[model samples]
Target: MFRRTFWFTSGVAAGVWATTKVNRKLKQLTPENLAVTAANKAIEAGHRLKDRAVGFALDVRDNMVQREAELGDALGLNAPVADRALPPPRRYAAIENRTGPEHVEGPAHQKNPYNRNEDH
Candidate 1:
């Protein structure tokens, strides 16, 4: 009968499909193939992690620069280009000569005894 023939064909097709799927799965589960698959997956994950870390670092650097700009503006360091007056030269107390009578460096430790230049 036509009905019996159709069912027989369908059953055979299903069995063949199932067998092919199982064979493919078994092949993938074999030691060498499984190791390769795992390694490939690990490489993919590492790439994704590296991309995320790079993005995070870039974001942090941008934020840091932006914050520094904000602080400079708040502290009035961002002077306009037109107001270009040179600041008065600064005099550091330590750098000034103190050999004058007002500030004598009379000697206990004036010249370090440990100085190899003087020793030589």
Candidate 2:
């Protein structure tokens, strides 16, 4: 009789413990809790994306250098393409001297006979 009573009490205690654990777990799985977890995951993904983009840019730059070296070998050129600097743009004369007054009297084509868009 004592053993039976002890077993029944143990069973009741275990049932209560299990119920409490399940309720706690259900609360943790609520919408707000889940949303917080999802937001944390999304933040982690964004950080990873930034890191991967930087890595990708570095990889592309390295690949470009390697390809440029290969092209130079194939073409038998010693100097890299980046060595050449473009010439500075030439300065033009005053706008008044080069082109006539801003407001012309006749149609644009009439004033400038050399206009390429002139009707044939």
Candidate 3:
């Protein structure tokens, strides 16, 4: 009876130690922790890319404005034109008449132009 008790106690102690070690290892390899780490990295990268794109767009806009100012100065116009003047209307002759093509009927042209055959 004493030998049996000793063996059972050893087995229980070994099982407890192994369980503690496995639990520690699992804590280091949890899927939730890994997913959080990956998501944070992706968010950080996206923020950096967005900042760079905005800065580049601002630089391009500033360059375009500067170039336009330089061109306006080169042109003798004191101020930019408020609106472009419209050209004179085209003159049409009353005697000249235009004729359109005559319509023709055929068996193949009887199908509806706007109808799609999807229901069939």
Instruction: State the lDDT of candidate 2 residue by residue for 1-120, as single tens digits.
Output: 999999999999999999999999998899999999999999999999999999999999999999998998787675666975677999864334435553456565345555443444
TM-score of each: 0.68, 0.51, 0.43
C-alpha-based local distance difference test score of model 1: 0.85
Candidate 3, residues 21-119, lDDT tens digits: the string is 999888867999788878999999999999999999999999999988888778744464665456699885443222412223467445355533345
- Per lDDT, the best of the predicted structures is 1
The candidate scoring highest on TM-score is 1
Report the candidate with higher lDDT, 2 versus 3: 2
Off by more than 4 A, model 3: 1-28, 78-120
Q: Model 1: number of clashes?
A: 0
Query: What is the total number of backbone clashes in candidate 3?
Result: 0
Clashing pairs in 2: none
Candidate 3 residue pairs in backbone clash: none
- Model 2 vs truth, CA RMSD: 10.0
- Order of all candidates by TM-score, from best down to worst? 1, 2, 3
